[model samples]
Target: MSDIGRTSAVALVGVRGTLVEVEAHLTSQLPTFSIIGLPDTSLGEARERVRSAATVADCPLPSRRITVNLTPASVPKRGSGFDLAIAMAVLAAAGTAPGADRRTVYVGELGLDGRVRPVLGIIPVVLAARDAGVDRVVLPVGNLAEAQAVPGVTLTGVDSLRSAAIDAGADLPAGFVEPVLLPVPSDDTPPPLELADVVGNATGVRAVITAAAGGHHVLLLGPPGAGKTMLAERLPALLPDLDTDAALEVAAVRSVAGHGVRSWTHRPPWEAPHHSASAAALIGGGSAQLRPGAVSRATRGVLFLDEATEFPRVVLDALRQPLEAGRITVHRAGGSAEFPARCQLVLAANPCPCGNAGTVGGPACTCPPSAVRRYLGRLSGPLLDRIDIRVAVARVTTGTLRASDGTAPTTDAARRSIGDARERMRSRLRGTGWTTNADVTGAWLRSDGRAAPGASDLLDRALDLGTLTMRGWDRVMRLAWTIADLDGDDRPDRRHVERALALRMAL
Candidate 1:
C-alpha cells in the first residue's frame, strides 16, 4: 500500500468558501486516528462518524497509526461537511482505491449507518469550487439541486457511503440501501402586497416612491393607524427586480444563514426584525461561528424597523456604518467576517410614547413636553441625519376615508415611473460605478461638470443658516436629482430642489 492519499474539501468563512486539501497517512504504530489543522468542535468529531461509516460500508480503516491533516493550517475549519473527504483519504491510504482523486472535491456528512447526509451552505461551497477551477465535486444527493446552480463543473451526488466507496474503486459488497430523503416543504404562497392598500396617505406614498426610485433611506413619524408600516412594506413593490449578480449574492447570503437556496427569487428580500432583537442578531456575530444577521440577509432589499423608538440606542446606532459603507464587518474572538448591507432603511415611529399626542379628534395629548422630547430623542440626531426623507403621516380623517376611491396610486403605475427614473440614473452614471443618486458622492455631486446649474440656491442658504448639515445638504441634492429624473428633465431645476427640501424638512 502507498500508505498516503489526498483529496479536496472546502472551509466556510462567513459567506466565502476557501479550498482545503485533506491528506491522510498510515504508519506501523499504535492503532489510532487523529485530525489536525485547526479543526473546530464539530469538525474534530468527524473522526468517529467517518470510522463508523467506513466499517459499515465494508471498507474499514487499517489497524495502524492514522493521521489526517487539512492543509493551510491557519484557516479555522468548522462544520461536518468534511466527513466524506476525510473517509475517502483514509480508505485510499489503506489501499481501497489507487488514490483519492485530487481534482475531485468531496463534501457531505457521514452517518454511523453509512448514509450520506446533506450539509448547509452547499451553494457557496460549489461556487468556491467552480471559482478554483475544480473539475468534479462529490456531495450528498440531497443538495444536488442547489449545487447545480453553479455552472462549469461536473457534480456527482451520492446517497450512501457504500455507493461512494464503490464508485471510488473499492471492492465492496454489491447490496446497498439508499438513504430516504424527505421532500422539501413548499413555501406558502401569499398574494403580493399592493400600494393601493394604504388609504389617505398621499404624502407617505409619494415619499416611498421617491425612496424606491433613488434607493434613499426614509423615516416616518405619525400617530397609530396612520399606515406607516403599510407604506414601508409596499416600498419594495415599486422597485425593479434584482439583476443576475445581485440575485446570486442574495442566494449566497441566504445559504450561509442556513436558509434554503433551492430556488432563487429575483425580487429583493424584506427583513423586519422586532425591536427586542439583540445587537448580535441585528448585526452578524456568534460565539462559535460568525453568522449573517438581519441586515446582511436584507441585502439588495429593504430593512424596515417598526416602532423604531422602542429599540435600544446602541443597537440602532450599529446601523450607521453599514448605511454609509453599504457593508458591515463583525468581529469575534475566532475572527471577523464582513457581510453585505446594501439595503434601503425604513424607520417607522410614533410621534410620542403615548401614541396619541398628535391624533386628531380622537385622544388628548397627555404626554408632557419633556416626556415627548425624551421619547422622540431615542432617535439620535446623527441617525436621523442619514435618512433622506422625513414625512409626517397624519391620522386618516372622515373626509379622507370617505373620499378613498380605487383611483388611488397603484403599484404597477409607481413601478413603471420608478423604472423610467432608474434608467435615467443609469444613463447619467454610466461610468461612475454607482447605480443610484443616493450612492453618489457629495464631492462628485458638487463638481461643476455634474452639478445641476442653479439648483443649489436653497441648499446653500440652508447651509449658511446652519439649519442643514453638510451631509444633509448633499442628500438633498441627490433627492433633487431623483425628482428631475422622474420628471424626465435634463437636470434638476429650482422646483425639483424645492420639493426635495420640503421632503427633508417635512417632519
Candidate 2:
C-alpha cells in the first residue's frame, strides 16, 4: 500500500514564478529514497536537507520507499525553495499530521539543523502566488518584509521547519516563531548629490529633462570635460518617484539579483556598465540559470553606457530588441526566461579615437580619418535611430563658467516640472496602458489627431529629404509630444517638430 500527500510550491522561471505541485509518496517496500521529475542539482540535494531537518524537528520519516515528484515534469525546477513543501508532504504521507496542506504556498531552503533559510526572489514568488489565487504564504522569517510588501496576502514567517509544520496544522514539535527583522544601517543617510554642479552643456541638460519627462533614450557625444557623465548622473534626480506597480517590479529584479533593498527609495535605477562588459553581463544569459543583466536591473530606469564606442559590436547590438519590445528572453538549452527591460538607454561617446574630434580642439585630434570612421561606426544607424534625443555636448569656456545663473532650477524644481508633464500625459493616456509620450505609438497619435497645425507637412518634408527613416519619423513625433508637454502645449506643432528634428539629426 502507498500513501500520498500534496502541497504547492513555486519556481522562478525568470523574474516571474511558475506554480509547482509537490507530491510525496511512501510505500511499504525495500527501504530507499529518491526524487523524480526534472530538478536541478540544487533541488536534488533538497531531499537530504529536508530529511535531516524533519528528523531533527522530531518528525522522522518512515524507513520505506519514499519518493517525491515536482509535477509538470517537463518544466525544469531550479533553486532550493521546495524544501518545506517536500518535508511537509512526506510527514503527512507518514500519518504524522496534516502536513501536506493546500490553499497556500511553502518556499524556503532547509538547513541541516532544520532552520528555514531565506531564498532569492521572494517578491516575484509572492506576486505569482497571489495571482494564482493562493492567499497564505509560508516563507523564511528573513523574507517577511519583502513578502509583506505584496498586499492582500496572509504571511507566516517561520524560523525553522518545526515552526512551519506546526503553523500548517501538522502534529509536530511546537515552537515560537521568531520574527526576523530586515537589516537597517546604523549610520544616518547621506545628503543627495546636487545637479547644479554640471555647468555648461545646457542643451544636454535640457535633453535630459525631455528624456526624463517622456522616458525616451538619449545619446551624448562630445570631447572629455564636456559634462557628459555629469549630465547622465543627474537624470535620476530629475525622474519622479515610481508608483506601487513599478516599485514592485523594480524590487522583484533586485530580489532576483540577490541584492537587498539597501535604500528603498522609489527613484529610478541607474546602471553604467564598463565598455568591457560581456553580452551576458549586459543582456543576461548563463549556462544553466538565466540571470538579470544590467539592462534588466535598469527596468523603469536609465541604462547609461559610457565610452560607448569601446564596447563589442555584438554586445551593443543585443540591446536593439529589448529597446523595441521592452523585454528580453534568455533561451538556453535548459529553458528560456523573459525579463522586463523597459529602460531608457543612454549612450555617451567621444567623437573619435582622440576624444577631440569636431570640437574646438579639433586641430589637435591625432586620430586618422579611417580611425575616426571605425570608432563612430560601432554605433550602427539602426541602433542610433531608436534614440530619441541625440545632442553634441561641448566643453564650457571660462567666461561661461564665471557667470552665475542663480535663476536656474535645481534637481527638485526640474523633478516638479517632469512630474507635472507626466501627470498631463497620464490624463490624456488614461486606460491606454501608456503613461508617457515616449511609450505612445505613432498610429495612436495619428488616429487620435493630436498632431497640430502643419506638422505632417514638416515630417513629410524630412522624410522626402532622406533625413529621417519611418522609425525615426515616429520617434521625432514622440519627442515632439514630450517637448510640447514640457512647454504646457496640448498638441505638438511645427516648432516642437522642428526642435525635435534638430536634436535627432545633430548626430
Candidate 3:
C-alpha cells in the first residue's frame, strides 16, 4: 500500500513569511527517519521532537523508514515552527483522515512531553496563509491573541500534539480531556509622558516639537545636563498615531525580530543605540538569517543617538541610504532582504571635547582648538546637512528652574498641533502618495509646491549668495512647507523660510 501525505507551514524570509509544503512518506524497511530540504539546524532537530511528542500522545509509530521533505527545496527554512505540521503529516501517512490537514496551515513547536510551545513570527505566518486563500490556521494556544490581530482568517488553538492529531481526524485516546485555551489578560496602555516635564531650554523643547510637526531629523548639541535625552524620549508622544496599514507593517517587523505583540494598538517604537553599536547592528546583517536592525526597529518612529561623536564614522555613514530612501537592503550570500526604516533621526552631541568649552559659567576647557575642531568634525557635512533641525541647548538657569512648572508647551498641546499639521499635509498630498511634508521630494516641491513670491525671492537670494547649496535650498523649502502647515497657512512666506534657515545648518 502507498504511504504518503502532505501538510503546510510557513518560513519567514526576512520579515515576509512564505508558505512551505511539508510532505511525509513511510517506506517498509529497517526503521530510519530523515528530513530533507534546506532546513537549518533548528528545523533539522524537529524530527526527534516530533517522534517523542507522538509517542507521549499515545500514537505509536510502526517500525518503518520515514522521510520528510519541506518542498520548494531550495528555500532556506530556519526555525522549528514546522514541528506540529511534520507530526500531522506523519499521522496522516499512518492512516488518519487527511482532509483537515489539506485545508489548514499548521505552525508550532512540539515538545517531547506532547506540549505545543509558542514560536516567533506568528503574525506573518497567519497573514501569509490568509492572503493565499487558506482560511484556517491551527497554531499554539499561546499564539491565539497574536493571531487575532489579523482579521478575515479562522484560527484554531491547540495546546499539545495530541490535540493537533485529533483535529486532523485521528482517533482520540479514551478518557482524554479536550484542551482549554486560557484567556489573555488585557493590560492598559499607560499615559504617554509629557513634554512639560523638562525644566528649561525653550529652544530644545521647540526644536523637538517642530521635528515632530514636520517629521524632520534633529540634532541636539549641548552638555550632559541639557535635557537632550529627555527631549528625544518625549518626541514620540507628541507625534500622531499610525494608521492601520502602517501599524500592521510595524507589528510584523517586531514579530519577525522575535518580539511578541499582545495587541496592534502599540505606539510608534523608539530605539536608542549606544555609541559602541556596530554597523550591522545599526543597519541589518547576519550569517544565519539576515535580521532587521535598530533602524528597522525604529521604523515609523524615533531613533535617538546620544553621544553621537563617539560612534565610528563608518557605522554612522551606513544610515545615509536609509535616511534618503526610507528603506534598507541587506545582501547576504544566501539572499537579500529589504526592511522599512523610515524613522525620524535624533542625534545629541556635546559642543566640544570637554563639553564645557563654550559654556557660560562652566570652567575653562583644556583641549586645543584643533582638537575641538577634529572632535566635532566626525559628523560629516553631507550627513549633517540631511538633518533638518539643529538646536544648541544652553545650560538651564536657576531662575528658569524656580519658575512655574507649566512654562512650556505640553505634549498634549503639541500633539494636537502636530496632528493638525499632518492632516493638512495629507489633504494637500492626497494623490501624491506622500503622507508628511518631509517625504515631499526636492523636485516635486520645486515643480508644484513653490513658496509665495516674497518667500521665493528671499530663498533665491540666499541660494545666489552661496549661503545654501542646492540640497540645502530644497531642505529649507521642505521645512518652510512644514511650518506653513503647522500655522494653517495656504503658502509659506519669508518669515517661515527665515525660521527654516535658522533651524537648518548648525553642524
Task: Please give the ranking of all candidate structures by lDDT, highest first, separated by commas.
Answer: 1, 2, 3
lDDT of 1 by residue, 315-425 (tens): 999999899999989999888888889999999999898898867787987899998998889899999999999999999897887777554588998899999999999
lDDT of 3 by residue, 1-507 (tens): 449978888888777777888888999987978899999888899889988988888885657888999988987898788998888888888886455565688999888888888777788788889887888999998888877888899999888888888777778763343443334444433357888898777777878888898889999988768788888888889878888788878877777776665536558877888999999999989987788999998899888999998888888889999999999999998787888899999999988888876777767778899988888888888888788898887778787677635587888888998899888899998998999888998888778898887786766887899877787788889999998888899889998888888777543
Candidate 2 has which clashing residue pairs, if any?
none
Model 2 over residues 1-507: C-alpha lDDT tens digits?
Answer: 999988888878888987888888999999777888899998999879988988888887899999998888887889898898888778778877584465778989888888898887888888898999998889898888767778888888889888877876776657654544445434332235566676765788788889999999999999987889888888877888889889888888877876543423476777888999999999888867788999998999889999999998888999999999999999889889999899999999999988988888335888899999999999988899899999999877775566635434688888888989998999999999998888988788778836886886777887899877888888999999988999999998989988888888776
TM-score of each: 0.95, 0.95, 0.91
Q: State model 3's lDDT.
A: 0.83
Give each prediction's root-mean-square deviation over alpha carbons. Answer: 2.1, 2.4, 3.1
* Clash number by candidate, in order: 0, 0, 0
Badly placed stretches (over 4 Å) of model 2 are 172-191, 261-265, 361-363, 402-407
